[model samples]
Target: METLAFIPSPSAGEIHLGPLPLRGYALCIILGVFVAVWLGGRRWVARGGQAGTVADIAVWAVPFGLVGGRLYHVITDYQLYFGEGRNPVDAVRIWDGGLGIWGAIALGALGAWIGCRRRGIALPAYADAVAPGIVLAQALGRWGNWFNQELYGRPTDLPWALKIDPEHRPVDTPDLATYHPTFLYESLWCVGVALLVIWADRRFRLGHGRAFALYVAGYTVGRFWIEYMRVDDAHHVLGMRLNNWTAIVVFLLAVVYIVVSAKKRPGREEIVEPEAEAEPEPGTDTGGPDSADADAAPEGSSAEGSSSAKEPSEDGPGRGKPSGGKPAGDGGGDGPAGAESVAKGPEPRRKAVDGPAS
Candidate 1:
């Protein structure tokens, strides 16, 4: 008998909670999302953004990401659900398994763009703030693959090799008891990538989406190697798995973006979220009551002081004569006379006969 040195897979990947079944795959994905949002929110706040912005944006991103991931998986593995003897209905059962990270990220970014537009936030700045969290989410999500007993590598006798259940074993490899734990390897690699991105972001002060680009590049580098080790059914091109080619292309593109972005803009963004404009009061101006008083005071004082001829002639002691009976700054140079005239009020006009005074 061969000596077995490996970790046993979970008997089942689900738990029943009073007729409601909770799948380990779904739980991992959900937990990863929460962690990502929590970490992203903190980073965003550090960049001078409002709290809960990441969660608000996630409302849109999450659904789009789920749908996109499912669509990519179905499209790429159409034979699994649409070919002869395949059950088409299985495609709708997303809880079972299968999610493409590339598609999820692409569509999720689109959704985030919509959210950022509505919230008046800069997408590039937000992407940088959330990059590390996104990678960590991926790391956490890989555990789901382990739970499902999928994504294993070639048979091996290593101590950390994963023990596959007879029912879950590959049909051609039914005799094999253990295999390389590709899922575990990817999970560990992703953790390392997350840390690297975080450290690089802090050290280089990466911004303008460069940090996110670095994350993509680093993740794809790990994925490229990890994908090579996975022996699952997949489409191949040029004797290589399709994902291997995708990883290579995406990695190169991400690297190019980082280089180009660093050259175009060399510093971190000063602000991530837009500053909310102070709203004007319903029945008042934004300048406040003091400003209103200042504005009206000058107009009211000027009008009252200059219109003395009209009001004083009709009612006050001035009768028809003007106030002081002399313009300001006359002889006496507006000293005592100006003060005395003001205290005594205006001078009245004298009543006179036809030609001369009677």
Candidate 2:
């Protein structure tokens, strides 16, 4: 206990402004969300999505996520909330703190789906692009509890112990003065997971929404371990209980989905350009133009042209290797005296047979 001690509390009023109040926790959250959304929008545009789509989605997603987070928090800990003279409406006081990661993601994805549908965009692509943003937002949100001096772990004498006010510590934990900084652990862990998802997304060309699933699985791995250390009272079911089991089960499912989906994707590697594709040069050999033409052509014309163009390959008169660089009977010098092949002609073959090597 004597080895190292640095106060965990920052100046209380450092985040205040006269009568108006602004908690550092809320500031961090806003900043985190802003940054995440901006980054996600940049990524979405890079991945061939329409501009402003992410922002549009955020309009819906943020509120839904917040409400879902509040509901999850309240539902899980209703006993404390309902007991004593607690008003039912106090559950709506999300600013006071309490968010559930599971609910936030579940409802947030729904919002994204709605946004994508409105924009006429594919769902998995947007999910993949925004996965990193979600990770960063979670990392920042965890700090909100940190600023509130809550969500610490069991009391400890470890070097990095967090200084908690007496009221913040769990009742059963003997040492009220010091506890683990679970917030910092989770925050840092989230950063690592975000980077992992970014790397895997670029490196392996994870298909469909596999990258997002990886994010889920990776976050779950860390959350499972970290959840074990949370001293916050929670409802328990099964051996380890609460988030621990949820994390494990969810993580396993995510992993299974990632593995199965990745395996099913075409093995030919793909790349995400993160930018709108440029218009192609006219008459270029790329199939894009021909494909567009095929799509635009009338059905009968397209079919007839396709048949005529492809018929040469199926043993047409001129299909085989040209005899002497001309069609078999074209009005060119086919001066073939016998069966032999040469760039110039069969003349060389005839001369070779007629003369000896000199």
Candidate 3:
């Protein structure tokens, strides 16, 4: 049968620019990372997290995710990189394309955990904020597979089939020209997953990582079916591909987490970053050292006068009047101590407000 139309694979995966080679696969991955960080940062800020926190955390998560993805691909498909005829060094060439989403997410979460802990942020809240962006990143990253002309499915003459190069075609089907575009299928599915996550998160007000869990479950459901379509050589168990089994396990786990987490802690987190919480109202007594000092002052004595006497002049030899004209102990001045006092102003405390019960 003559093919009417189909997607054409790229003739070359890399381009040269002044002796520097830029791989399409690498470009896609890089673009995906930037997009993820941008979107995640917005979501995080909306959730009361500090702006740019997602990008800061991405510094740790991205590298760990890349390494984990490459390791997973090499380990699972050892025959492609190991043995007498294969080159072990090729395994490190990630730009050539090959990444396992499973390993990338697993290790990426570990990296995010480390980043979150350093920032004194909760991992679940961070995950919830970035869930949609992560899946969107996967959607963009799947284009890498399209550029490399790998991971196509069984031969088909469908209009949307992918035309594989003769050299890239499976040895057993050298005569076949077109095959199912599993990469496109997965990419489109990931996009849908991202949309679903965003909608569900808003509609249900998912929290405690439940938004991330929803994305995981939704992606796995698509992966289970998409993985079945692929003809690429992969380990099989009980007549099903290894990834199929993985999808099943991961889907179940995600669902369990969503249900249990909702029961334990329902609704979204009121405060994503403790440090970003609103400070006590101005002139409101915070019960800090300053407040304690004011309470202990004599009944007729002025608290400000007593504080000025106890606090040293930040500028010169005067206590109540400084060279800057600002009163002493008022947390204003160019001096180091005054600057320190201003910078370390009372730590903000979260106001308690009960969330609706699940």
Q: Candidates' lDDT values, in order?
A: 0.81, 0.72, 0.85
Question: Which 10 consecutive positions of candidate 3 have the poorest summed lDDT?
Answer: 348-357
Residues 291-331, model 3: lDDT tens digits: 78767865544456554444443444633445766443334
Residue 228, candidate 2: how far off, in angstroms? Answer: 1.1
Q: Distance (Å) between predicted and true CA of 344, model 1?
A: 22
Ranked candidates, highest lDDT first: 3, 1, 2
lDDT top scorer: 3
lDDT score for residue 78 of model 1: 93
RMSD of 1: 8.1
Tens-digit per-residue lDDT, 80-191, candidate 1: 9997899999998888889999989899899989999989887888899888898888888888887899989988888988998888889988988899899899889888
Q: Model 3, which residues run further than 4 Å from truth?
A: 17-19, 278-358
Off by over 4 Å in 2: 1-3, 11-14, 267-358
Q: Which ranges in model 1 have alpha carbons more than 4 Å from their true place?
A: 1-4, 276-358
Candidate 3 overall Cα lDDT vs. reference? Answer: 0.85
Cα lDDT tens digits for candidate 2, 278-316: 435577656666677777654434633444443334655
Q: Can you list the residue pairs that collide in candidate 2?
A: 46-274, 46-275
